[model samples]
Target: MRRREVLGSLSGAGALFGLPAASAQGKAPPLPDAALAERDPERYWARVRDEQFLLPGWRAFLNTGSLGVAPR
Candidate 1:
């Protein structure tokens, strides 16, 4: 099949499966409150790590330099 035909089929299949289109997906969760950070530093950082970043829960990403992964 042609590239366009393949893409069209995939798009239709995505719709049939009830997948959300790019624009339809809602915004990311808001950043945790500053007060939470001050009151409970561990809990605050956990929220930030879990909500802000897209890394898998099983993985540990510790490189925050120029080559670090950006937040999703």
Candidate 2:
């Protein structure tokens, strides 16, 4: 669907669901960096299982519309 159409639908659904306005959306929790693994297997899994998955490049991390990660 087109951007405007999709947004319009979301707005209608939001109202029907009694959700807050679009601007009142909740923020994604911060993700721990891959660098924090300290070169260990345990710490690596810690980030993978907990950190928010973000695509590489730009502010893809801030986009709530995406939940999958593309290879960096």
Candidate 3:
């Protein structure tokens, strides 16, 4: 199966196992403003990383195995 499909299925399984889905964590931040991206690409990407993903800020995750890290 494709990577995205695998991750999606895993996320569903997480829900079945009583983990919170992304939406349940909180409301997602608004889409980064296009003008901000145009004006400051680095800042825009930082915003994307900080707001759009659930990765923790305290650690680096660098798994390169077949499954890699789960989506969130």
Candidate 4:
């Protein structure tokens, strides 16, 4: 495909997947670390996880296979 067509296809796919545009490009915003640490760690993390924008029509994932790695 041409460049424009490829870009359009990728953009559409991102929207269809329910991924926030920025996060879909691997630019996930940092969560508030201090606040999270002060609260119950497990409960705070569960709230953060619940806020993630996952693929459309999906409920939950049992593993990390679909998640991206942090930049080094």
The backbone clash count of each candidate, in order, is 0, 0, 0, 0
CA deviation > 4 Å runs, candidate 1: 1-28
Show the colliding residue pairs in model 1.
none
Candidate 3 per-residue lDDT, tens place, 1-72, comes to 999999999999888876556458866668799999999999997787677766666656577466553343
- Clash number for candidate 1: 0
Write model 1 residue lDDT over 33-55, tens digit each, in one string: 99999999999988888898787
Considering summed lDDT, which 10 consecutive residues are worst modelled in model 1? 18-27
**Model 3 RMSD to the real structure?**
11.1
> TM-score for each prediction?
0.51, 0.29, 0.43, 0.32
Better of 2 and 3 by lDDT: 3
Tens digits of per-residue lDDT for model 4, 14-69:
78777676565775546646677686788676555644444332445556687642
Instruction: Answer with 1 or 3, whichever has the higher TM-score.
Output: 1
* Native-to-model Cα distance after best TM-score fit, residue 6 in candidate 2, in Å: 25
lDDT of each: 0.83, 0.60, 0.75, 0.62
Candidate 4 wrong stretches, greater than 4 Å: 1-26, 53-58, 65-72
